[model samples]
Each structure stands twice: as C-alpha cells, then as structure tokens.
Target: MGANLILVANDEVASDPLQQKLMKATAESSGAEIRFFSLEKTIQIIGRAADRQKIFIVVKTPKDVKVLVDGGVPIDEINVGNMHFAPGKKELTKKVYVDQSDKDDLHYLKTKGINVYIQDVPGDHKTEINF
Candidate 1:
C-alpha cells in the first residue's frame, strides 16, 4: 500500500479554501495518499499500530507537536516547514524562527528523543516568510 500523509491543523487552516487547495496540490505531487484531520482525530489515529507504519504527519505548530508527543504518538523525527517569522522570534535557521515557547517545545521533543529538522522546500529559501 502507498504511504499515508496526515496533516493536522487548527480551524483556521481547515476553514481556508486556499490552504485546503494547496494541501491537496502538494499531496498530489508527493504521490502519497493524504488525509486531513483535526488535532483530536490525529491524536486518536497516531496510537494505532495498523496506522503507524505508513504515516507521516504534518502539524502546524510546536504546540501541536507537543500534543502529539503527549498523546503517545511514536514520532521519532519531525520536519518543520512553512513557518512564518514574527517579531520577537529568534532565527534558528534560514527556514525556522522560534519564540521562547517554541524553543521550549523543541527542547522537550529533543529530550524525548525526537529528531527535529528544518524542512527545505523549493522556493522556501528565497522568501523571508518561509511559507
């Protein structure tokens, strides 16, 4: 079977037609079967053995990553992409910016043995927004 790519996000992303359209386009290009879920549903699915092997999850925020980790999701690594820079956020890399809380969360994940990387997508390096 093909791998499953799960995208978990908040209501803002769920309600945005453009975001939805873009997600679908990315999924199509990736050749993986893609699914969208609310954080609640994602938490439920992540613990299932049958669903774990072929799943790659994409979450919007560091808070969301913490939620998944707290829910006992077996995430060994995470790729963070499309992050937007805001005032008061420190630049972690060319594509990543973090506030104190975000840094804390990333540290927590690292302590829990999860590898986190800045995902490099085409055109992402060209923009300050990183979106």
Candidate 2:
C-alpha cells in the first residue's frame, strides 16, 4: 500500500492555521505531501459564476493532496470509506451547509479507480477531502 494523502478545506482565514499545523504534522508523521487549493480560487480558475455553487473535488494522493477553502460554499459532511466528516458553517455567515451525499458521484469516482478519504474539522480545524 502507498502512503495516504489528506485534503483539507476550510474558510480562508479560519482554515489557514489548521492547514499549516496539519501540513507540518503530516510531513513529520506520515511524510505526506500537502497541496493547498482554494475553492474560491477554483471558481476563479474555472471561470464560473460566484453566485452559482460549485462542487470542488479535493483529492488526496500518495504524493500530494488537493484542498478547497472557500468562504462562499458551506460543506457540512463528507464520507470516505471508514472515515467521515461533519462540520458547520461560520456563525456570522448563516450558510446552510449540506453534506456531500451524492453516491453516484462517488460511484463514478470508484469506477475511475480513485482512492478517497474525507474528514471534518471543528471550529479550530478546517474540513477537507482526501483521496
């Protein structure tokens, strides 16, 4: 088996510290590579409308992990095999975050032979997807 990859997602401000901490920890413990990607940045990169919601894919690999930290999108729960993630939105934003409950999408990922893991961080930590 290969080394695991961990993806982290969060609000830009709130998630930065935790992502750094997690990166350090992962580097020290698992020798994992961490890649930071912003959902907001992805939106800008993809040239999508900010008002329309987009589902960003954060994948973890043996070499690195992809992260999506967007202030606009609210993510509540994510699942990956034995691991599961649950988190709420910022109190000030009043966003109704929803769980990633799309099995067909997951099934497609499975069909594509991808490995994924999911995690949620509380107020102090940022939630992110892994693959």
Candidate 3:
C-alpha cells in the first residue's frame, strides 16, 4: 500500500496541540516525513514529491494551490475547517490575508462557485485587504 498523505489546517495548531504532537511523533517514528507549513509552504513541498512516502501537515485553512492538485502526490487526505461547512463566515474576511499578489487562489475559488474581488494598489507587493 502507498503511504498516507495528511493535511492539517493551521487553525488546528493551537487548539489541537495534542493531535498535532501525536501526528508529528507518529510520522517521525515510522521514518516517514511530516511537513508543517503555511498554505504556501505546503504547496511548495507538494511540488517536490517524487514517489516518496510523504505527509503534509498544514496548520492552515485549505485554499487552491497548483502544487496540491497538480503535484504527483495523490492528495489522499486533507483535514481542515470546523464542523460547520462554512466556519466563521462573517469573521473570515477580517481574519484571512492574501500574502501574495498571485491570483491562482482567487481563480481556484471562482471556479468553484465562489466570488472574489481584488483592487489594485500602488507599490503593493502583497495586496492588503480586510478580507
């Protein structure tokens, strides 16, 4: 059987320390690898997959990244979000930030029936927005 691919959302880091610790320990024990990265970092790692047994532990929300889907990795498991399908909708726009100007994420969401609006600002490498 192939190795497992695990994705842990960032929100779980502080609230689910025990589970995070256990996953880390287990991956280390099995000589498998565990990577804890932001959504961006996780996507970067996914690009490096080359048939190795890999597990990605993302302590962040799930967003669209080319590497996650296009990378050869099966992306067998992704653990994110709360019990609610749309958690903290009202507060999300305030809490999340767009770290880079790249709109791959925006495109991904739009394709999935989500709406996103972007405003151009001068000299803004990372566009800052309330949402």
Candidate 4:
C-alpha cells in the first residue's frame, strides 16, 4: 500500500505515544506527510484530497462517520475499527461494539448507499454488515 500522507486526529500524536511513534516510523519510511487536525476540519482536508487515491478517514465512533456523511464527505464504504466495550453497546466483532444509536447511524449510512463492514485493523478478516 502506497501511503502518501496521513492526517491524524488532533492532539492524538501527543496523547497516544505508541501510535505516534508507529506513525512517525511509517511516515519516515514511506515519505508520508503527517498533519494533525481537528475532527471539524476533516471535511475540508478530505475535500482537498478528493482526487487522491486510497484516502482513509478514521473516527472514534459511528456517529462521527454519520456526521461526516451528513456534512457531505461522500463515504461509500466504512469499516468499523476497534470500538471499546461499554454498557449499552453490542459486540459486532470481538473488537467492535455499538449501541442502538450507533446502529441507527449505520442504518442511516446504509440508506445513503454506503456499505458497512467490521474490520478492526488492516489484514483482518472483513465482514459485511447489514441492518
């Protein structure tokens, strides 16, 4: 996979030392530029990278994706990443969890012709999800 640039969620590089180190190595080796931006700025960044290949946006929850789609980010297929367990959340995959609200967000995405799936990380088995 050719990674040209990586846009990390704001302040994450400092808070997540391990991830920061990993991404730093990746950036150094792959010549990928890493920019830290707020969630609110994702749409603008994505808009600029629209013509680029293999753009990946990672968010904390399903609602974030719903917000992006609602705000007009044209996401067609989204793979749910590691969602830590919480009381009202249902486990879709061992690493992925969702509450009813999360399910509603997914359903909304599906209604918009956006495919959804479960894949906690790269190289993991991907499972298509339908509501």
Q: What TM-score, over all chains together, does every model reach?
A: 0.77, 0.32, 0.34, 0.74
Off by over 4 Å in 3: 4-19, 25-32, 54-131
Which candidate, 1 or 2, would have the higher lDDT against the true structure? 1
Give lDDT tens digits, candidate 1, residues 40-91.
7777766663745587677788888898888776788777766678999877
The residue pairs that clash in candidate 4, if any, are none
Show where candidate 4 strays beyond 4 Å. 9-31, 121-124
Instruction: Check candidate 3 and list the clashing pairs.
Output: 8-58, 9-59, 9-60, 10-59, 10-60
Alpha carbon deviation, residue 129, candidate 2 (Å): 18
Candidates' lDDT values, in order?
0.70, 0.37, 0.43, 0.74
At residue 11, give the lDDT of candidate 1. 48
User: What TM value does model 4 have?
Assistant: 0.74
Preferred candidate (lDDT higher): 2 or 3:
3
* Candidate 2 least-lDDT 10 residues: 89-98
* Per-residue lDDT over 3-109 for candidate 2, one digit per residue giving the tens place of the 0 to 100 score: 24333433352257776675667555645454455545543443442443333334332111122223232333333332233463112112222234334444344
Report the Cα lDDT for candidate 1. 0.70
